[model samples]
Target chain A: MSRTGFQLPLLPGRSPSEPPDTQDRTRALEAKGASEQVGARVRRLFGGSFHLRHVDAGSCNACESELKALANPYYDLHRLGIFIEPSPRHADGLIVTGPITLPMREPLLRTYEAMPEPRLVIAVGTCACTGGIFAGSELVAGPLERLLPVDVYIPGCPPSPLTLLHGLLLALGRVEEARR
Target chain B: MQLTWLWRGLRTGVLTTRYPRRPERMPDGWRGTAVLQRDQCVVEGAPPSCVTVCLPRALSVEETGGDRRLRLDHAACIACGLCVAACPRGALSISNEFELAASSRARLISEHRPKGDRAA
Candidate 1:
């Protein structure tokens, strides 16, 4: 009922001037709950070391390329104290890319299960967040959140290296301002 | 920052392709699509190495007489560079032309004969 800063239109049969009770009920159901707002948690761990491990379930390699590009000279994400680890045991965060396919479901679950407590999952790309174009495919069993709690979501078909860097920074609570 | 920006700008210009309006010259070893050459095919029951070596199983040969007819399935092709390596007669070579857009998927299948081949 409330347009506010929302870009998408309200569903059909829902009037903008709905009663307060109706609006409250709708908002309660529609809200994405609350995420640990970017700045608060990050302030406590500012300048702390963080290791990321990337997982590709069944992507077209576009997202993986962008993720790799983050370490390139122009966008050296490692300069921000973020390192990409090869194993879950060494990682403090999981960066998942791709629409989780049926075969990849078990492996993704196993990888997430292997990570220790206090770990975070950052779903990078539309595929990982909401399954993107492959959302309803028979072969797809995910939108990573179905199996694990995703702490941060970076939305893009294949998010640019800079966008990914921003999301990681946001997850770490380093980027507090609403710059984008 | 200025030096990095300048370097990136130069790199972007160099990497950009002149596509759609201007035809792009595909770089060396770029796999465009598979082409069928019916002439150089050996029809005397000799094994067609091109067909056998196709990683995607995209190439097939039909024996007629002294000439063998070759057919290529572009959709099935993964462009793995095996078929080109198997062509003993040098009849098959990877083409650099990658502009394979078509209204119908069937048009992607290239049916071309080797140069100076009368049978195709």
Candidate 2:
């Protein structure tokens, strides 16, 4: 059977409908005021190309889903020069999700130590930030900051992809810093 | 060539959000952050009813300088929206502001003391 494919020629560019205001607001909110120095230092070291190592200390997997979305096309985190490295040895930053579970404590610590100097540990999701709803659970080991010095706190049951992007940008000093 | 993929792509458009610059368009049931209304809590009653229903126990009433104030740990909150719905006096409600990231843990905490109830 012979068939003709329908084709339309359109300029290849970001869709015009993706409203600019919302994205700007999210960026404004991600601005960290006091970390200006840290961000600048980090940017100089990595040239804004942040290599992240993700670890799920102990979580319900909600955070992982959002974390994965960072690599999706719409978010296009790669365009910003951010990447998820498979090994802590190659990573410049550790993006942790979930509450620090009892068993994962050792593993998490090892990952942090494995990272190179000028390293950053970012606690993404409410769980990693403050134990979240799992705080009182006997099986939980509390927040990540209690164990490792956290550089950035992205608080949410699970932060949105844009929030994650902004948090990374904040850490690298791509955005303005604010205190609040 | 079918070119069906191109047609599908054009129809679906971009699925990503334009957040940060403009505010996110949260759905009807989408739950955001929580805020405590001091005056409303007093009218409903001290040690607000929402505290009891809070699953994570993230909300607690503490006596500061002889005045009972509600403390909310934003990091511990799951954003389940239970407290927001449980409040009889509308003292607790979920805000549209979802960007809760901060450099310090202290910034995530919110304390609301009853209006006009000065600590001695």
Interface RMSDs of the predictions, in order, are 15.2, 2.6
Q: Compared with the true structure, what per-residue lDDT tens digits does model 2 show for residues B9-118?
A: 88999876555454555566566567777667762455567888888778988885677778898777777888978887877877656456676778778887766666
- The lDDT values for all models are 0.61, 0.71
Estimate TM-scores for all models. 0.46, 0.76
Enumerate the chain B TM-scores of all models: 0.62, 0.74
Question: lDDT (0-100) at residue A75 of candidate 1?
Answer: 65
* Candidate 1 docking classification: incorrect
Residue-wise lDDT of candidate 2 within A5-114, one digit each (tens)? 66433323323232234543443345324245445655685545668899988778888898888778777777667889999998878888888777776677677667
The regions of model 2 sitting more than 4 angstroms off are A1-38, A41-46, A176-180, B1-29, B43-46
The candidate scoring highest on DockQ is 2
Q: For each predicted model, how many residue pairs clash, with residues at least 3 apart or on different chains?
A: 0, 20
For A1-180, candidate 1 gives per-residue lDDT tens digits of 466665443333434233234543443243222223323443455635678788898988888998888777756666666899989988778888888887776677667657765567788766776676576777887777665666676654466565576577666655532211
Q: Lowest summed-lDDT stretch of 10 residues in model 1 chain A?
A: A30-39
A54: Cα error in model 1, Å: 0.8
Best by TM-score: 2
